[model samples]
Target: MQVTIDKNSGYCFGVEFAIQMAEDELAHGGMLYCLGDIVHNRMEVERLNQKGLRVIDREQLELLHDCKVLIRAHGEPPETYALALRNNLELIDASCPVVLKLQNRVKHAFDLSQRQDGQIVIYGQPGHAEVAGLAGQTGNRALIVMTEADLDQVDFARPVTLFSQTTKSTAGFYKMKALMEARIAAAGGTLDSFDANDSICRQVSNREPQLAIFAAQHDVVLFVSGRKSSNGKALFSVVNAVNPRSYFIENEGELQDEWFAGAATVGICGATSTPLWLMRQVAEGVESMGELV
Candidate 1:
């Protein structure tokens, strides 16, 4: 059997930058606190944690004082910064530039909307760290639309400016935008009153077709990803749809020997938040499962 790792797999630019920052900070002799998992992958988090990266939440952040904290790539709401200021906690901001730009755009749009009765609409999972950060730009007034059920909460009659989380599916965002436009048009609303930005990151959007191709070329796919990764879920669906033999796993330990049955070729890949080293580990695990025929 042959085992290969997808060249396009592993951490994105934002995640790479964040992990680097954490490593650089950890290299220094001092206590370091990260607001959340440095990356969504559990193995990466554990690796960092082994080097003294303390994970803390908002509530815990408030109780701490005069500490140095690193914000993960997911970005944080404005309240996090404010609390850090009040608590005298120095921040190591590692928010992705794409996300930072989207946040600014959302905030600007929200500010402009406040002049009228307009509302800011975001296409993202509710309560997701990135989505929460984007919603915070609208002072928590941005309507989060994750499904058809949430779409009803948006006011089609009023002016709306739509934005999406950096990692959301491009097709999904397009559908959301089209649905909003249809709703407004059906209600006799003018198109000029509504605006939506294509905020989904191209790096992720481009990976969909590439991942589908990778999945199809293999007999079985081991897609490594953290359970908490939104991009992981989105990309995995693409692969699974293309190749039902695809399997998702967090680590090499999750690999079952039975999965390799009758498979002459196996592919190993992962989400943007996944580390390359973890993919290598998974490949090694597959190698140990049996002899290549």
Candidate 2:
């Protein structure tokens, strides 16, 4: 049996930066608090937790008045930073540069739109950390559009500036944009669709095409990813669609021997948030199991 790993299957720049910041802080032996999971991957979070990184929520921040806190790569709202300052907490910001840029774009667009009697529309999941942060920039003026249906909440006659969460599906974003434009045109109203940024990180946007090729090259696929990662979920769908023999697992322990029972060639791939070391371990486990068989 042959085994292959996808070249792009591993931690993306954002997750890599966040994890490195956490590890650097932990190695110095100080009290470190992460505002959220450093990343969505449970294994990576647990590993950091073992190294003395404490994950805290808003309430926890309130209780611990004087402490050092690290903002996750997901990035929090300005109010969150304000609260940290009000509590006299030392801040260690680790927000991804891409997310930080999106936040700035949303804030700037919202500011300009508000002056011109326009609205800021965000294409993202409601209540998601990133969405919440972007919405906060608009002081709640930003409208969240998870689907074309959510467009009903906006005034079609007015001008709209659209932005998307960094991890949103590019295809879905374009479809929603086209639908909104169609609705406005049908209404015979003067609608200014200002900007539609494809804010999705390349780490995710590039995975679909790569997965399609990877799926075609292998007979059976072992996809490793944390269930909570949005990018992982998106990429997994692509892989499964292209290759029916694909299986998803969080780690080596979850790998079922039955998956390899009749397979001659295997391929291993993982999400952007997945660590390379973890994937290697899973591959090694698979190799060892194959030898026994």
The top-ranked prediction according to lDDT is: 1
Clashing pairs in 1: 1-293
Residue by residue across 6-118, what tens digits does model 1's lDDT show?
99999999999998998899898699999877888889999999998999877788899998999988898899999988999999899999999889899999999999899
Query: How well does candidate 1 match the true structure in TM-score terms?
Result: 0.97
* lDDT by residue for model 2 (142-198), tens: 999987679999887778788888877767778888888887787776545555667
| Model 1 stretches astray by more than 4 angstroms | 291-293
Q: Pick the candidate with the highest TM-score.
A: 1
All models: lDDT? 0.90, 0.84
Against the true structure, what is each candidate's TM-score? Answer: 0.97, 0.93
Sliding window of 10 residues with minimal summed lDDT for model 2: 188-197
